[model samples]
Target chain A: MDERERSEMETRARLVAAYDAMSPSAEVTDRVLARLRDDARVPEKKRKSVEPDSRSALRFGLFLLPLAACVVAAAILLRPSAMMPTATKVSQEEVVVEETVDAASSDAAVAGDASVEVAEEAEGLAPQATKSEAAEADAAAGAESREPLCELYPIVVTPEGRELRVGDVYAGKFDDVRPEESVAFSEDGKRSVACELIERDGALFVRYGDSADWRFAS
Target chain B: MAIDLEAVFRRHFATVYRLCYSYLGSASDAEDAAQSVFLKLLNHPREFADSEHEKAWLIVCASNHCKDELKSARRTRVVSMGERLDASLGATDHLDETIDAVLKLPPKYKDCVYLYYYEGYKTAEVADMLGIPASTVRNRLRKARALLKDSLGGS
Candidate 1:
């Protein structure tokens, strides 16, 4: 054998002796056996093989129960024709005929009038805003346009006419305000955003969120 | 089937512990690993084709467990300085230096070197036990020798 082969053999011999020297104590063996003995005494249940069950289907149905209810409620609340008086209904027949006659002359104007009626019906606003309140709103909207663009806050309105909440993004115009920047509405502007529009005294204002107040431009 | 737990422990404990100690480079960790291996056998029994199969299984399991332990964040946080191999085996002064050098090897090579050199296993046998290709085991052994030669410095 060459010198390198002999040296390799010597190195192997030394490693073997060193590793063989390290052995576990008797206590470890005893402890392991004791653990096994203790475990053996404990009763173990028979393991069941996995199989598909109807319980999962039942659980899935139960999970969807609330979602299904929400969908149905949304359908009823969001039906477009439900907001208008039913023409065929016995109670609203006369009102519907009157509305039909009025709609024929100014169908476009009726939409704006319908908003006033809804606000009144919902008790969200005072009755017809009187004549003085209407003047104030017009003054507010007029004064808002004269103000510098920076003074005005972007109010994003959905095509559906509902005012969107703060931080909600929609790609469309709300009156004169165009979709260019993200909209963030606020009331007090200190804690959290409140409403999109606010009426204090006779003046109407749009909250730009975070202590920013501007006249209602739309 | 009732296999004698005590007999198995007595016969194989030293081999298992030595394999763990060589892999881990720490006496405490070796003992813990060896105990865990036996507990695994206790909890889950398997039919061994022969005594060779049983020994090979234990070695593979112990090596795999130590490798996993070394991978843990805790092991990395605490660097392992080599512990004194038990003196009861009556190792000479030269043997101690060799063992320390082996322990200092990178983990990738250390286990293979230990199984091949210390356990008196052929390269093929070590490969089979480690679930690795024989060519890979030979490569590790060769790399380990070069590292050991450099570390030992003309020893």
Candidate 2:
């Protein structure tokens, strides 16, 4: 090799040696595993489906509580006309769901199933859980827009149109926030955000959440 | 793909930590960045075609995370703990000068040069690993060499 080439080789050798001299803390593996265990506590996943059993439904119901009002208001606003598009969105999500299933299940997945099992064991022993501690299975793997929060909670509207599951909305603060159903509501600007849609008196008002203040738009 | 975390971490941790150190210039920050990369993998698990794809995913993820960290408001650049340890352990006198030069290269060139030269991957392999064109990798490597040579006393 010429002088230029020799110098390049020398530089490469020195840099490589410098890099080799370095190593991570011995506890890196333990640190990472520990962090995963901690995050699994919040359990950032939705069930594969709303199970037929009451226990699963009740467990899942806790997450869906926040979305009830927003969904109902949307349903009222968008019944016969909005039906077609919502159906289309579901189909699109179905396609995403299919893709993610093959990718996630067929490919080696990570850290969630064991977590779920641990959660189930906890659930059996405890009989009750604080919402954050509740272990939930994650699905809708590929779609960024999908909210695992459910259809989880009670949005049951009485015949007189009162008590629309006010409070306790828990749409997660995802890194990539793709709002599922955006109303004219813009509390802190989350699209299709989790909010309480209250029918107070005769007029309706919206309460935006799993964070931010109550926003009212009649 | 069966994700054995211990296996994957053992395989990729050095590379990830090195890349992070190169970017952040601090061993503690590099370790933090490296852990975040693995945590992301655990959180958003994806199917890789093979080990190559897995490595590529990690390089990209680590690069992105480092860039974000650099851009964040709270970012503080500290001296490399590894560099200090290397000196304390009595690396050759020129080692620090060479490292400082390597660190001076732009981030893109730094990655290409490190993978191409230090990591000892061929140009085409570096291209594949970086998801960039071989020509682009070659170009970066060429530019990196010129830059290195300029500092290290060669044409």
Candidate 3:
């Protein structure tokens, strides 16, 4: 407000004069000093407890907040859903995956069970084909040897709340994946059922049960 | 070392008493409120940065205490300037009337009016002392002046 200060008015002067005339009576000062002296014996620690304020509580709550966030993040991070995809290739013979080529058009599984036999056949050193044919067989064996590994995290909405748990880790390529699918939304495995891996547009997807919608692996 | 209570009491007793009196408009009750504020200072001692900080803390506490005393059920209608101050002013009509009018204004407005008019503090200085924004102090003073205009008579 740009209003002019009403300084020179008689009312202001009168107010100034009246308040100027007043002072704390001697009786009040004596009483206050006496009271302070009488109570000064108590320790500061004891005095603080008697008069509690919200500032300490507010500070404590603020301090614990970041720690709480870190704990929750750690818990979530420990689950495989937060794990970044690693490019550690497993040779075909070293892997113990049970492969099947069921529902050939829809199922996306790397059915490289022929890889072991093909390796053995190539190693036998029997005269079977021309050099061109040997090259074709070696090429086919190489394609079946290295399959990328993928893991999935499936969640189901339950009565309590949404739960995120590791479904299973499967070793397969986007070209094909066939694994025995099972799930337990709770302690009991009631929700566990058959699932089929589907490949579409170069991304691996899974469909659990007949009624469940096809979901992309995350 | 702890603050020198005797010196502080001597220096600030009147200013605190004056502020409480402005809000409460009664000498005896203002005494009680002022005592309570200083008692708080004694009970819970704080490390002050400077003399201004010490004085500001007392003034703010006294203001809060006076507002509380007025809000408490024991306080009824605000007491007028009455015979004690009137005789002290030698029966000055305008000052007595203005003092009474200022006491009638709410404590929020009364704080600015008292600090600005009697204490001779600038608006920004009053805001710093009261721990409020300067604009808020100015707004309160404007409203307080408007309230006092009836008795102050447009001037």
Candidate 4:
């Protein structure tokens, strides 16, 4: 053989020699086969007091319950803030109404004799007075409530024409909102409102016409 | 019904364990990896189409499992100068050094060398096993031979 052929032959011989040398010890295969045989035998089914089918079904249901709860928690956690109803706004409205009614009734009770004449003559006037007084009370309550709203100030109108409301306590993409803007909204194929920008606490806020509080333009 | 796992084990255990031993250089690890290969076979026996398919699957699975264990252990098989000289004495002793050198090569080249030399697989078989083109396997083998020749002093 030529030198090149000789070199090729030597290389092949070396590889073959190496392969033959490294063949696993007989004990390795014996151990593995032994383990395999040991693993193959099915364990005897114990005579269970419980029905196997029902037990398995119950176990499966138990397993799925946590998974379902996790899925629900994840859904609740990952759910869009826009889809969740704003409890803050609803609660704020309720508080405002409660305060106004309480103040009106207290004033009516304190004005005992005056309230009797007022109740008689103002039976006609009573309704108008109550309506005007309620309106005035609401305006005053709204102004007083403005301080807390301005202090934290959750809602913001973005430059992208989307209203960004705080969905949770912390400031992020997802936070709950209490609406500070009270613009007339059209409920068509889309519910939308437009409000101008107002600044409070070094942040740009949104203000609908005649609204007492300023919302953040997020 | 389950396939005859014992018959499969009896037939392929030696080849599978030898392939793992070549890769890992430890009888214990080879046994462990080989057992894992059979356990995998037991769990998913329907994967094989025929006897030839089963053999090829065992070799590939054994090789892959050994590599994964080696990676997890953060162990690289580095043959020392003394070890290399010791390996050159006998074909079987030198085999670990050859494999260690092969493993030191890049993954593509290492696999080609292992499949071609240790498993006695044809280049086409190696290509099919690795899911690469046959030409790629040939090129890798050529590069691996050149590398091994250089490392083993051009012998």
Candidate 5:
């Protein structure tokens, strides 16, 4: 090789020597391996409970048959039929759904006063005058009581814009509600809607079949 | 037989680290890039035809990863000024001058030069690792050598 070629070759050798010397510290390897070990220890996929066999599935279905029938019956009874007239009808009954603010406000005009409206509405289909009297008495006591009254409307409604029947169990969230003040409404023998309000969580949450993680209104 | 990851890591970590260090001027970024390449191996252990293929696979992985890293906004914001030479190696003026000149070359030429000279990869091998044409790799090396020679005062 010529003089310049030899010099260039020597320069390339030196550059390689410099780069070959550059490697990370040993600690990086140790840390990486330790992380990998931890990863290997834990399962990559979630462990699922064993699935039931066909016979078990059949048995479970059979067990739930009666309950399923009851739910079906309830749904049939609660189905909004143009031919069916609601048992409890007040001069003005509004349906309030929390998510729809416009519906809540419009319904608020009809179902506004808990004492007057609930009693008046209950009197129409309530089995006994005494039942209405007792509910009215409760309303009167609340009329004088210094506790905050929260008007709860079923979040779910029939397509015909009606509230759930008194005996129907509601499964949903409540916003700005006390569980205790919360009531699961049922109809009296007179077919009038009435609430069986129970105190829960310092009268904060109304117990509906079971407590759920409720997503409150933002 | 299954591939031994520990042996692979031991054998190729320095080359991978240096490749990344060349692409990304920062030592820390190079370390991260090297570790990430190894992590990818852990996640999906690929089978190679032979030791040469395994080494080529690593070089390709490291080269592609560093190319992506350089394209990122983080790399743009934090440009590593120069090579972080090993303290022992930096003591020699000639080695330091040559390395500094090589690092100063544009990324395209710098990569070609490193693979060609430092890693002892032929022009075609460098092209294969970089996913470029052999002619392009030769051109880059030619341009890089000319630049280095000019910068090093005919040496």
Candidate 6:
């Protein structure tokens, strides 16, 4: 070997010798072992296998309550319109006739001395009553214009029984109503009663406001 | 499955303690760090993948802990130069002079010298253990040898 290599080897040897001569502490192993044993024994209670059944049951019940509530809330939000029914429909022609007759009676009552003259005029022109007819038609048209637009369709109350209709008059109550669905009334049934219509999930529901239940709107 | 802590302690305690002592140059700190190492093993016994892994981890952990203690001691001004010199000397005569020369060398050179000679690690193994490039280890070792030779009166 070269002198440099020899010198390096000698240095390594001397350092190793110095290290070997120095003794380690005698109690180090004992101290380490004691600590390990202490660690293994602590927390013994947490490792026990026999927990009480009642405590476990209580924990399980608590966990399931929130899960059950979440399922119910999801169901309600997904099907909001399945809660009510639609209102009855009123025809514009009938409303106009009723307003015309009422206006004529009021006019006769106010024109007290002219009442005889108006009645005579009414009788003679009852047959050729073109002028009166035109006046009645105008009056009917004005009354129809004054009626609320929401009164044309059924009103739908929310599932919480809150009124969902836009009109002031309540149409009717409905059962199992859903939002966005249309309701149809029977041919002979009164079409003017306020009905609650709930539309949900591409289907319409109709029910009367006074009733406790709803039917699918046809 | 839980590890056989007693068996592991019995098998490697001496080596681990010795490694810590060499790193810290103090018996008290070595013992404390050694105990801490075993305590850590007890808490998380499944960390080691195999026997070799466990041994390597213990050495690394103990070494790191000892270095931290040394840093704290220095910061607190509790690390007396005379005491360190005496501890490094142990039973060796004229160790003060030898260590003074070693200490005068740069820290990188000193680490290579101490691990190679004082700790009895091979150059390649020391390189792997310290996570340094092997060429760097070679250069440090060469530089330390030159410095030591000059200090020790070698031509």
State which candidate has the highest lDDT: 1
Per-residue CA lDDT of model 4 for A51-151, tens digit only, reads 24875776578778899999987885676754656555445544545544455445666865344333333222222133344334444333333222223
lDDT of 6 at A50: 27
Worst 10 residues of 2 chain A by lDDT: A131-140
Error of 2 at A152 (Å): 71
Which residue pairs in candidate 3 collide?
Answer: A108-A176, A108-A177, A109-A176, A109-A177, A110-A176
Clashing residue pairs in candidate 5, if any? A127-A190, A166-A186, A178-A204, A178-A205, A179-A204, A179-A205, A179-A206, A180-A200, A180-A203, A180-A205
Residue A108 lDDT, candidate 5, scale 0-100: 46
Recovered native contacts, candidate 5:
0.53
Residue pairs with clashing backbones, model 1: A186-A209, A189-A210, A189-A211
DockQ of each: 0.32, 0.19, 0.26, 0.26, 0.23, 0.17
Docking class of 1: acceptable
| Residues B1-155, model 3: lDDT tens digits | 13487678778888888898787777777776776787788777787898778888898999998887777544566455463363434545655666667667888887788788887889999988888999999899778777777656765
Question: Which candidate has the highest DockQ of all?
Answer: 1
lDDT tens string, model 6, A26-57?
A: 45467667656765776745423223477467
| lDDT (Cα, tens digit) per residue for candidate 5, span A145-207 | 312233444343533554654455444433333333444354333332323243232232232
Q: Flag regions of model 2 displaced more than 4 Å.
A: A25-42, A45-218, B1-3, B76-90, B153-155
What tens digits encode model 4's per-residue C-alpha lDDT throughout B51-134? 889888887787778778666523546634444333324544356556555545665465577678666689899889878899
Top candidate when judged by TM-score against the true structure: 1
TM-score of chain A of each: 0.20, 0.21, 0.26, 0.24, 0.19, 0.22
How would the candidate models be sorted by TM-score, starting from the highest? 1, 5, 2, 3, 4, 6
Considering only chain B, what TM-score does candidate 3 achieve?
0.87
Show the lowest summed lDDT stretch of 10 residues, model 1 chain A.
A43-52
Off by over 4 Å in 4: A42-218, B1-3, B73-100
Identify the CAPRI category of the predicted complex in candidate 2.
incorrect
